[model samples]
Target: MSENDETNLPVDAFEPNRERVKIDAGAFVQQGNTVYRIAQVLDFESIIGIAVETGRSTPLAVAELRPVATDKEPAAAPDLTEIADPDWREAERRFAAIQPLLGRYMVGRIEVAGRAKEIGVDTATLYRWLQRYRATESVVALIPKKRGWRTGQGRIPTFAEGVIDEVIRDFYLTAQRPSAQKAVIEVLRRCQQHGIDAPSPSTIRARLKAIPERERLRGRGYKEKAKNKFLPAAGNFPNADYPLAVVQIDHTPADIILVDDIHRKPIGRPWITLAIDVYSRMVVGYYLSFDAPSETSVAMCVAQAILPKEEWLLLHKVEAQWPVWGIPRMIHVDNGSDFRSDNFKQSCLAYGINLEFRPVKQPRYGGHIERALGSLLKEIHDLPGTTFSSIKDKEGYDPEKHATMTKTEFEEWLVALICKVYHERRHSTIGMSPLRKWEIGIFGNGEVQGVGLPQRPVDRLTVLLDFLPSFRRTIQTFGVTIEGMTYYAEALRPWINAEDKEAPGKKREFVFRRDPRDISAVWFRDPSLNQYFKIPFANQSLPAMSVWEYDQAKEKLRREGAKALNDVQILQAVTELRGKVEEATERTKKARRQAQRRREHEKNISPAAPILPVRSTPPTPSIASLGLLDIDTEDFGDIA
Candidate 1:
């Protein structure tokens, strides 16, 4: 075999094909200069391939392979931020029409006909919308025809349309509350002045009626009426008939205190962000962190919920089957600032997930998730470091003095409880174990057909990138700078100092996604290719650090009267601060916690050692043999 045939070749050899690629038999994988055709998949971990040019046989590890973009695949999802308002509204309307059909086992002709009639569209048109939405799994796919006018579109001239809009905004939408006739008269006069044929009075009325009810009321100076009419009414939870039909996510501080890895002393409670499947009452995903609840926590928890958990479980050395994974049809959440952020909303829309906010002041609307979190916290109350929920409950117990478990240990214990205990034990409301409920919903019982598992995303990293918070920065000659750190890669060469096409004189702002856990690299999405490239720090000598640690270091320098700082000075400060944290780890609770956080970041970025692929659906255990007779269940009263 030639020296180039070795898999140890540098990444530079495959520079031309360095875009996102999928793993599959017959797919061409380019590593350095060698282009190999995947001949066969021996297992999930390895593949046998033949070099295209040399016709030489090669065995490749799946982990070492990188995906390359191909023209045969569908074009990347549209940038929702740039979508026109009218198009966005149309897409939402179409999505609403076909939402019931999504995630169904099968759509029968009768169901399609009924839905079509309800939405006032023909069955054929409804099917087309369903096909498009399912094919891309994106709301953008349902956008109305953009190139030409479709049915019900105005056939009037552009000038006439503009005149109509001006009249509606200026005349119709006013405190005077002018009549439709008056608005039509104003539109006619404007069209005549512009030397264009005026649209009929009926067309003008139709356009006025097209305005949203809330917007119309507000524009007509009926702000109070709009608010009164639009306030969400408290009601029972929406029906979630199947698994992943609806998942509720929320954040709560853990009831137990955690000790640091080094000193085993009590640190403050960590926040837990959890996602629960409403139908089965199964815990889908969770994130444990010292940081307060933010968009980052939501993103992390959602990503974990949607991705396979086998690898993550193995990473923590937890032996259990957590079979829940897939995109939910709808995510029900409270009206928190983090949940309502544009970044989070856009990410959900891109993935075809409907985001429904709970009505204000309605505790019962979120009862399912709240109860699930309560149960988990109740379990935590039994642990040695438990805060015991209330002051009365903890009157004699000293939680801080009794703190024993480290964060990692607590994570493992929580996973065990969720998988082995809660999921396996029978529930009061469902009258069966959550695992069994999920199984029957996904795989189906004798009467009802199951919808089966959701289509696993081909690019797991891209799925995560979509959920991560994004920043827009102009690429400088040296590269893009974010939060005092500079990142650069050869992939950014063509975009250096690029001018914005929309605004010729201004620099272009490119989209970059970063994981707050690790600031060593940021993922940049190329506008032309629509692929993410990992850009590492320009100065490679700087050690890996979390954004929190970075901020702490910067704050320390500010307190020390350092007026100005560069990337190098800030990193030096971080290094010195880390040393002090290590030195004080045994003496102070805060220092020990900080050291633990640093270790977590390091562990997160470290490469995971390979493990055997866990079975997706393990054998269903018998409920009778699980000894549920002594288990107590709480009744939340018909959550579904």
Candidate 2:
């Protein structure tokens, strides 16, 4: 088939492909272990394909075919910065015109006609633009074709162009805004002094026209006006008409103290990272940990949000259903350093998620997540060992003495409260329960069609790996070393001491993904095979340990004035420290908490085994159990 025929295929043909896989007539797709070559795109729902090995025709649904990543596929996302300014602006304009239409599951013919009329375009043209935009989910896909001389490659002499640019920047774009004619005059005068032919006045005028309106206003000393025109309205909340359209995430310290597993004494309050869907006000994902808020907390929460929660719920032994799961279209967060990390930004970009930062000094931008967190804290205040909200509320109460729930037990109680209480209760703002609202959004009401469940990821591990922080290291004869840990696999043999392709004679740094919760193995992607291989620890006999524990061990050695610490010495120290913690678990709160944290980290890394036996209904603490109330009240019938 011709290349044009391949390029014109419907967007559905490319929906299930890898990040940079090209969707075309001859592209390869996989179904389980079978492979097929696309013969033709029959329709939006189905495709005609031929089995590669069997040489037989097969009709396949568009949803069944997954894009096969090969060496020919592009390795990175498109650099949108390469597009000319005019093209980028035009693409943005097109995107703004069609953004309202994108949230709908199905568009009626009348709706399309009305939008086309509003935009001054015909039906066919509008449909074509929509198709292009949907295929890539990027504004650059709508860029108009270049029909004239290439940008930045004009016929003007190099010196003349430089002079023009300098004059525009210094004179034309200053607070003392000069008239276009005067700017042109200045350019011509400069050219004359250099003894060069001056360009026409219209060329300079066109150049001035190309400057963006926002830049022009700021250049002319209208900073306040520019801000008013460009910034989003602070009072109104972000509009999210459908599920997964916008998700808000934030962090807060839990209001209740948790006890250690062995000693049953208070350790400290754990931090909570929460993600809520704006449309339904549902708590889609959360993370609880003793560590402070950081990139790992955000990553773990996002991973939980994207993957289904049935297994996680089961592992926690909570007999409740949590149906929320999907890749959100946009994630809204505050201007914290964790949210602004390069790793988080690149991961979201790779997964086609947009990251929006809260405006400086605008607290209302994140009000949704803040309010939800507040409600959860209120519920926590009712639990044993509660700190309440403030010192005034916590006065006369000793939370550490009353603390009774271990870390695992507290996790179970939190899950129960989220699924059974919070989700079931009606929300004042939404006028319905969160679970009900989520159901209506996903399954649809009578007025609109439901979008159904979001597409499940091809590989859950791959999705998690994408969101994880990465490190780069050069492979040596022994293997790759990271943070005093050495990992090795046969896959690194070919790349050992490989010279950098871009910089001759310099070593090339290969990328590796790791979970800080478990340092037993790291994931390495083989460039030649286009697949990931797990590189285990060089000393496989060493027990798995968290990065935090490793740091603690190293710090202990430093405190002892030990010099020249190596991997073996660090591991030995960790082993000895663990032994001390185990022995002191019965008496010291710190040791008990350390043991609990280690178990929690291990459970996160591998969740196949349940920590506690399955319970049909976990016991709830009562006022009488704390020696507060002994009298029982008779059951009262409903009063009029």
Candidate 3:
């Protein structure tokens, strides 16, 4: 027969033969286990012929043949080394119990029950589980399934779910947070409008409970609610992962009354600027001043915190070690005006310290520092003159009468307390002394690490000048005028009377940084050379006095109606005011507040240049140290 005619023959025509058949028509075919490549084509759809070992032609269906597997098939099994739980082991055990009965019809009910009882399960449950296991081939199927309505099934009509969800979102999660009953009423109202049957109150409650708390808050509640109720608690410093990672700064009025240096009489409370390391609960730095908390106080505290305190400890005759010093990676502070100063922000940025201002009205972010202040104040409460913490605590007690410690004495006592007691004593949060923790962080660990030190100049005067508050002044031909006082430096000679390119139509303005503690000599930076130059007052005869002193002196001049005042007149006013302050038997409340302010201002003046010689030309020193304002400068501007 022709090849085309043979190819059209019916599948049934082919039959096995003992003798050799030509079988010239070849195609891919499978007999029992092996696939044979037929040499010639036959009927392609139904059957193909192959030559076997018996030398007979055989016919097989085309459906039996399959192509060989390629590299796409995985060569090895997957990993299964993970530990299995008891439930999984039980499921595996149950599956093993049924292994023999697989693919076999049950012979008798009694036999099946006996087999299930062996595994502590009923026959009916076993069969159900076995059927599920067979379907999924997973041991997990042997575990009993959770009972009913897990996915909001049968509670509400399928068509009504969307309408009810929308109604609940609109009425339930508002700022007012209406009750579940109100949400149900709204849901029924919407369902009535949409021509759908409303779910029962119980059904509606179930559906509402079905929605996740997070999703409900996100969709319906506003950001404030979401943040307060749904968000996780923020991480604090004590639980910090590393040392110097975070620091917290805060201010509180000390709970004790301080006396003046000369009279030993009571003054108002001194404000304490406290900065504590979060990780170790160590008091990194603190500043005590009668002036209310200001940017200068913050700068003073932070600079002290970042520089080694060996010299300070020695000066105060403190025996214990106070090793804490480093520029913290981040500083957490409240939204006080002092913390928001441009000089504070810029200085922190220049040194790669992150200044984090806590949200307004949120005191939790600074809890560490707040608690430290509380602890320190508790220690102060044990001293001679403490107001205690609250009115209830201070009832019928005479803080003023008991007040014997002057400001200087109180400061000395504080230094001793911080070093000998607070640093050495065990802290509750860390369960160890802060000094011990500091040592462990630096040297106790096996790995190589060292304590961080300040990168900038460590000179007490230089550091003070670096962080002191600054002002804008134009260098006139005579000198640069600030706060009604004219200061001239040799460095100002070249740029006198020039206009600033950055600020149009304005005289050339240079930055003059000054310590509020002493306004006698202000600092001018030669921006080109990046060197600091100390500029002296043009008058040449004024003694070094705090901005507070200068203000009190100028106020006296204003009251005396002196039209043109010189250094001599200012000094006389200051001397007269001091005499009046000293003569008063009992200082008035206003007088006490002013004295406290004066004490704070004077305390901030660097001991480095306590007394500068009177000279008109600016004092020139080796490329080294230099460190705000005029008469009304203290009146109109913030001392910080």
Candidate 4:
């Protein structure tokens, strides 16, 4: 196939193949198992013997390679320096303990091996140990042992016969119902006390995944859902930031989520909310929701985002004990309703922290929380489970029915476990885990405190308040008038007066100076009142008025209505002049009703006034006899 055709091939058709390439700094590529370092395509064929799986790169794998200093750090000579046998044995013991925890299907074995190398022993040593122990156990047992399948199907599994089942069961429980960090640590500590081997996060993740999907969700037949990422993760640093200044929030709906307390299944999707500290990527607050998350959730998230780590975990314990203070200096939030609420704003004000709203419709704006939720969702639900109930004869029926969920309930638990499982547990992003992230000052919570933004209060507020969009109202009753209401200062009132007919209409504006102490009141001037005064929102409602809206209305009809009413009144007066007075009031009421319906019908099709329902039949009024004034003096407050 042509390179373009290969690129077009379906993703499932793609297979991984490892290849090595000699490439210069910054040029990198990877195929299934091996990543090629190539300065150009020439290096692909000339340098590494491994074949490329595809013309293009597998993004997840390619993301791991860096071309800098591709020259290998010289291989070590056989270690002439002797270490104690016990030291090697301890390393060997740790390796043996987690070997069964590894999954065969996972794509990143090389990455896992890299982590092992960082732990003091290389991947080759670990493999040698697995083989060495197997041979030794066979000799000791005095039996001809059968070979074990690489894939775990029928088992030749146990070297320590009882330990495998026992460890698997305990590991399964943790996977089935993950405990808070404190609880998990306590369990691990207890295991240490009793001389049982404890598992690391990697092992815990893998073993927990081994439980049958149906069993994992505490039900029969459950398949997991996958999510996509818009951006790659940023590299990490141990001491990168100040505390409480930046927090990230994102939404994820839960899946194979709990159906009820006793029966859990993957039924539907739910919105999971989380706030993480930008510096450490430790989840500060989280909630999964079955409903459109409300302001209450936002307030709760703010509270958690600000508190200390251990205390944040206490919130999950049955016997809860935690502090209430420690609110952040500023919180990074999306423009969704929950975060945009007036109540949330007040909370920020009360705590003297700034609430920074992210751009509309962009999830990546809060990348830390966005990425963290994806990791948690994958860990708890998607990675391990493939198909729940795969019986051959059933027609179109998924055996995974028991694992299905409703979106609403999924949202509910998506919110609940955000704190219980995701936040209070260890964080893969920060790496100290959630519990350690707190004690380690990764948040810099106590040592590096958040500083609030300085406020420059302006008295006339129109100039300054306009910057923040306080509130706006129309010029309802022109001229100076107030009922103990505060008005915009006299100086800027004229420039903003809607009654300035000689000047341009677009130039008119109203700005309210919102005081944090008295948010309900804004300052605007009653032009006639010369003195500056404050106006409460109840007394003024200008901000929503739009010239485009009123311009779109039929103004000509308004003038015609005045003329028609005058003409009707004239005829009624003329009839009364001749002492032939008809019940004019009833006729006028009938005309008014007809006019209203006619106006409504014509509204959408055209702005033209409706055909007069009165027609020309039985003319009831004349233009001459309707005694009417042609001036608008409705608000002649001081006019003579």
Candidate 5:
């Protein structure tokens, strides 16, 4: 390997003191990538509890997990020497001898991630070796072979014969078709053409029942038992009657590759994000992105799903796939790192939408997204288009000249087809097309009224005033100016003055109450009484503020901008209004005094001028004279 390659092998991340292992090889598990509870060195027999995977071709993506310590104790490592027996023969025999030792050293009772042949030497031989050759005084006796599943009797091509084999392939590919029965009929016709005596079309009807192979393995996954079957559930979703109460989101690497349009060379594989309604099984939002699965893509999927076509058009006029569906009350996703990121959580928080996370690596909780990915992977893999390279073909194949193709275009074509086929096509379980189910409002509650979605305006601007570049010198005045626009908030003003202006650094700004009527996610601006506060921008702006522009500025750069204006400008705006409150308050007091005097005068009693309250006085101090030192006279005589 090149030195560069060696450098990139996670050498910087590895710590010598800990067992910081990076597994180099493993089969793709159908969820987030890393297999949990993996043992560094595994020894096992017959790969017991070996989960049967259906689609090895369309592998599921697992999250890239970095185990973080939240006050978590370091993982106790298994002592390797405990299992390596010097006296034992055959690896299986050695394991049998050290069963008790392995049990004590290993954290868990069951060991996962083992090679099948390493331990399983035909169950009988393994057992014989375990007892006679490898058993130690302290080791527990090996349990002899339990009845095997007996599944290895036949091979794949022979075992999955008849409609069962045909069904597995056809069911997944054409599950979204309008008439799945017709699809099965087509398969039967193909079989007949192959010289097999095919059954009549009517006779094929009853045989169709045997096509559901997946149904047999239905309840094989983990499920939680009900704590109280009769009790009403808490945290019940909004609108029990709505069809779109829950939505699940997931991202999978699209089969399509992005290519440079100018030079049709593959740039990279893009991602396809899917948002599906849990109730109607409707594809609410579908987005194709060249970037990694980020909160931006996730939020876009949600916005595209929730906002109506007109609203989307008002915001993004040119896009053709703008969604016209309703908002999902609950957004469910696997506990992937991206989904748990602050960017994603902030979006959820801003929208007041509930974000639900499935347990780590649990695809079954987010089964809708998983199933959608399954369909997408197959569809894209099967899609055909002319492949191209850079605009200038390096390989010498040129069309008019050296013409090339991009995978992005192929992906776009696939996306369109899949959306039409998978989304518009009928679902097997729902017994209706996604559009049909969506329109009729058939969801978790069995109601006719569809889900009511939340409306998030695109115009809301989020900014932190404390960090604003123009924040200093701008103080609480009778009024304040932001971006050259002035606003009148009566409650705010008067925190700016000569004292504030001459003071070093930033002076306090005005305190403004938040208008309850405002829908934008904004808080009232209160000038810091030596404390911090943030204000909202005007709900809408002709030119939208790029959220990053302010955040990206360096402290020195922002302070330079802040230095442009001083507290003097704020004093000018608000000093005139300062006397208004005090003067008004005094005038009211004087008027009350005058009225009371006039009432006394009318009663034929000359009221003495009401004395203003007498000021408090200080007590007088006693006085005395003091003496002085006499050394200066003698020094004057010596000088003379």
Candidate 6:
């Protein structure tokens, strides 16, 4: 075996003082190709118990194990080394005065005595100090020692401690509410019967107080109550000094009913993903979707926060300016799956953004974002289709009967209110409006300018495309098939049946990017030239529809007894369902609910989901396919 093999390596393979190679419990060690965590140190420096990934315990020799070192800083050594006992420093100081005389042997005891007198110490004490200082480099060695009985003062015998503990567990710590005085008497009786020394009542009382109240309560079978009563409240989260230092993201269901764009009927409440700058208390960006929170929703919300919104505001007809844009230093989030996803972590790492998760069950860490959501929802409670915030406030109020604004109208209204009203209103905490605070944070107090700077700008489309779901596919004779949809593009013709040179002996599989919102086309990157090409669906006659719409339509048809459903049949079903929802006059509750869901499904799908770099001229079927060229803008499809 090679020397790199951890299990086969000899004891001397590693250096004697390698800092990472620790033998303590809880340290990580590598054996062969597998890494094991040290569960316990069985013998001081000889044997240890290690737990594998599957939690199985295995015995390992200390010499055979090598500790694993990560990018984190090394474990700190004990801090007691620098400090010495009292009088150590004084003794060392006195010794320094007679050092020259002590070095000369010709100088007799009389000279040493004279030197000791000058330092205010007797000859014997001076010699003792010198002897201790020379033997042990630490000055602590010169201090007087606590000898004999002083070490055991006020201490109970081990056997007496055991007897007292037995009496306490059996009598004192029970649900019967036993008297402490009686428990102490019983402990004395038990110790006397066993011929062991009994602790005095005062000593017993002191020990009883030393036992934690929570532990006592738990011993009496009040575990939950004791925990609730004694557990400390979460500490306050420290505020950031500057804007964009830390941002928090959270999702809450909006407290209002929304209507369909076409039919003008009520749909369910939309989920709002809100991002806020903790320092300025300013709303950076938010996304409203009928779909539940997911990785896609998180990606879209982050993209909105990072990119410029001048064009988006104009399109939505909101006149207020929202200038916030930049990658935050760190993002604080809850332990939701969307926040924990690998995709989100990788994306944040790519932009040098740190991800911090709030401790589980600790709401104080995310109080800033939670309070922001609460305030926003409180404002929404006064709207036409308001749910009034809670069951108490919503009692006797019919939200659906009052519902009037469509999803699009609500979006426009929300943006305008956020920018024009909320941004201008004075915040109690900061003593200024969020917009004003942001201005001060970005600009200055008056004289000296702030040190804050905007992050490097990146292409908005590039970020959007990079976040989309990627799939692996081989360039087969039948073009590329994704989710049962075959896509074809003339640019793929030259690379057909090509083998991937990077992975020898493995079938060549290229990565394809897709936006689940619109299944009309997918983007493929040519590995050799490092350029992306869009390939539309094989059939040109099919109507453009969101993935949710198509899936819902297919499921509805299947429930209606249709078999062997095809894309054409599914499209026909979608059209039929849309018409029924729009024209129905007296519908059942179920049908109305289905119609609302359909409306939400369609409304959330954006027409601009995939924002890949576009080109005007097609590839010339020459070296141009392998060469690089600047990209131009082109619209792909709607975002689902």
Best by TM-score: 1
Model number with the top lDDT? 1
What TM-score goes with each of the models?
A: 0.73, 0.68, 0.56, 0.28, 0.34, 0.55
Residues 356-436 of candidate 3: C-alpha lDDT, one tens digit per residue = 887677667777888888888999999888999989989999998899887768877898988888888998877899877
Q: List the candidates ranked by TM-score, beginning with the highest.
A: 1, 2, 3, 6, 5, 4
lDDT leaderboard ranking: 1, 2, 6, 3, 5, 4
TM-score of 6: 0.55
lDDT for 15 (candidate 2): 12
Ten contiguous residues minimizing lDDT sum, candidate 2 = 631-640
Worst 10 residues of 6 by lDDT: 10-19
Query: Please, what are the lDDT tens digits per residue for candidate 5 over residues 182-271?
Result: 745665666656656554443333233323223322222212322232122432323323455678888877644444443343344556
lDDT of each: 0.72, 0.70, 0.60, 0.36, 0.36, 0.61
RMSD of 4: 34.9
After superposition, candidate 1 runs with Cα above 4 Å error:
1-71, 103-127, 143-236, 446-449, 605-640
Clashing pairs in 2: none
lDDT of 6 by residue, 1-640 (tens): 1233334321111111111133445655655545567676553224445445467778875434543333332221111111122232332333454454533425567876876655445577656555543322222333333243353233466677777678778888888757778888888999889898887786676456445566689877787888677543443244365778788999999999876654566766888999998877888878887767877677777877765565567757898777676667678899999888755664564344657888688677888899889889988988998998779998999998999877678888888878888888998877899888887776557763443334322234445554556666777776887766678888678778887565676657666776665567777765544456778877777665656667778789889999877667766897887678556623543355456555544343331222212211111111123222112111111111
Tens-digit per-residue lDDT, 169-286, candidate 2: 8998899989888999999999999998887675566566556676789988889998777554643354476788889999999998899766677788889999999888889889
Ranking 2 against 3 by lDDT, winner: 2
Better model by TM-score: candidate 5 vs candidate 6: 6
List the candidate 3 regions with Cα displacement exceeding 4 Å: 1-239, 444-457, 501-506, 553-575, 585-640
Could you tell me the TM-score of candidate 3?
Answer: 0.56
lDDT of 5 at 338: 63
Error of 1 at 125 (Å): 5.5
Candidate 1 backbone overlaps, count? 5
lDDT score for residue 425 of model 6: 91
